[model samples]
Target: MSIQYVGLKEIKGSLIILEGVTDVAFEEIVEITLEHGEKRVGRVIQITGDVAIVQIFEGTVGLSGSNTKTLFTGHPLEMPLSKEVLGRTFDGKGRPIDGLGEILAEKKIDINGSPLNPVTRKYPRNFIQTGISAIDGLTTLIRGQKLPVFSGNGLPHDQLAVQIVQQAKIAEGKGIENFAVVFAAMGVKNDVADYFRRSFEESGVIQKVAMFLNLANDPVAERIVTPRCALTTAEYLAFEHNMHVLVILTDMTSYCEALREISSSKGEIPSRKGFPGYTYSDLASLYERAGMLKDREGSITQIPILTMPNDDITHPIPDLTGYITEGQVVLSRELHQKGVYPPIIVLPSLSRLMKDGIGKGYTREDHPSVANQLFAAYAHVQEVKALASVIGEDELSDIDKKYMTFGHAFEKEFVSQGRNENRDIDGTLDLGWSLLGILPREELDRIAPELLDEYYKPYKKKGSDA
Candidate 1:
């Protein structure tokens, strides 16, 4: 039999203090009944001796200290799992919101997730093609890797995320039967949520996506649970059903802000920028959940997108994220001003796991050489532009002038693409070769002699006054 207690200890922000509670486990879900028997849900966030503090998921409103009845469920929050989760939409707490009714659960798993042993982990290999030249050719996203997109306010990160969802696939013409996506949006506006849903449905990719949405006006407590619920679903699909799952988490900064708010309400001592000191571990708990098990056939790849606070990458949230994830795709405000859609700052963005994923049997033999050469040529383009600003473009040497033309075409034709345009790997690679043709043959130093002979077709430099 369960014990019921009349709550009257205190009412704080999103938390309600319950006195004389026994045998209550931490993180256990609670059932709160008002005097008139309106049901509300909560979770045990803190336990000090016999006093327990519960965070209400539906916000703490309309409850009196004298008339409230609380019951501890003695179990942590669990998400119902099945193959039916795909194409479904759920609230932050894993409750169905799409009017599809409840999931006939095959089994229920804890949202906190089962701890994965580091020794049993498998090294990531191969790449997930996003069909965008900038991502596929440069910062390649390997299967089972955790790569983040570092964006800022008012950038086009949302559009980029949508594009990836629509176009991402396992390499080498692998069918969609084995791939799926899980998207979580925390603290987004209702219109933005509607846009995400509409865009996916219109693109016909919604059937493979499961979305967890926590709106901006929702309780802050729900924001904290959003990503965990999304990952829990991904794990179920990947490990149980042997599906390669790609999980996209957007606006993680909002989740951290919710943590800070909860910490402030708990009266805990503040750390950097008034956030809890455990911020790093908290983020790691989410990111580390992605990977392939040594013996498992499936994998989970994560692309967590967070907007930098005040466009400052040095802020504590991004600074700590840099330490946890493999590498980042940093967006450029300068490129945005120049009418670039994705606005990816190529020089600063990279995937640490990319080298192992591309080349030979994976993407192409020339992928590594082409990417390295592009990085070198773009770096030189910056130098020539700086010199041009100082001494004007007309005074530059012939080779510098060639670089000027290459840079212009590179950004216009390569970095920028239509919102709906999707290119295959061969199309992207062939485009890279064509762009390299703008430079002289001697300038292509990164490729092997045989590859240069086979792929390089140098464009003749234009004569002065011609």
Candidate 2:
């Protein structure tokens, strides 16, 4: 059977109704060839009877009802895979944008596929030390895990992303060859594009990196295809090529907005202030694609970053992402205002895989104790800040006063660090001890004295007395 666009009829909204296709699978990318010889692609967003709902990828810029032939490739969009993909740049649809040349792909696989069985996924139990102490020391990222970063507008999340790429190191006992990075940006600026290029170039990792950029000015419809294409490439490299891949997608909010826009064009019912009701499942389809297969040496670990509109963590994008991903690295506006770089609000940021990735062979033996004590101490510090706001610091109980000091020290010493600073696991564990030292001996209930004796040192460095 051949695809011939018989006629086009205006549907409910911006969507164009096409007749003549009896059967087409869901989300299949259709190629449309115009009389003028220009070729464009669209997706089979919905189907009813012999009529198909095709959302134009580049939008129907110049088109007529006649002379347009639609070809349903009978498959969803797929990305090309090969080692040659590394350090190359591509547009939203996986076409190379770096201008060097297109990849001579060995094969292409459908982007939409069943997720790895939860039970079959190897538990992520190793940390990736991204040199920034704020991350390695606090909300550590684990390999084979999906831990997102929730940020706000005007925050330095991009800088943090750049820093992670620069500083993130392999877990001990793993060779550098076992690690790789794949970055996908949706609706970002040209300057942002240049920054990543320059940073990777400076680090000399552009060769080992692969970038898929969906710029703000590009067709909004293309945004939806960008991340999936990126992930498909990652899966090929990690699972097929046997290379460990770290996938980072920034501003997922843009991705969601594209979904909503397409939903509106389709005249579908909206949910949560005009967002499509299927958003949760759609996000799940993308996020659940990450992880290490039990039998595969190479794994895909995702760190998706998004800025909550108006700092609303309850926003549909961040809220839904929280449900599907393993954990989050939540940012804080309050902390940002206080001038804490990286400003990771440790109380809210967590890696559910932390337990599996810490202790013994993975990291320092005291890693568990150190993380627990820092978390507990900082939590109490929040309480002290609230109490001090109600009553004077002097009026508070003695223990409350210690909590207050610990809180300040946690931010100034533990959380705040330079962008270039990189801390190893031992240094991270030791730094946690340094911050805990400000509290009196009795306040160290989260950690055992034996552990403390092994790790703890007074905050004051030894002077010339040596």
Could you say which candidate leads in TM-score?
1
How high is the lDDT of residue 433 in model 2? 84
lDDT of 1 by residue, 1-466 (tens): 7898986699889999988889999999999998988999999999999999999999889998998999888899999999999999999999999999999999999999999989999999999989888888989999999999999999999899999999999875553688999999999999989989999999999999999999999999999999999999999999998899999999999999999999888889999999999999999999999999988888999999999988898999889999999989999999999998779889988899999999999889999999999989999999999999999999999999999999987888888889888987778887888889999889989989999988887653335232
* Model 1: CA > 4 A from native: 173-175, 459-466
Over 4 Å off in model 2, which ranges? Answer: 11-14, 397-399, 461-466
lDDT of 2: 0.82
C-alpha lDDT of all candidate models, in order: 0.92, 0.82
TM-score of each: 0.97, 0.95
lDDT of 2 by residue, 366-431 (tens): 878788888888888887788888887989998788777778877877788888787777876777
Q: How many clashes show up in model 1?
A: 0
Q: Least accurate stretch of 10 residues (summed lDDT) in model 1?
A: 457-466
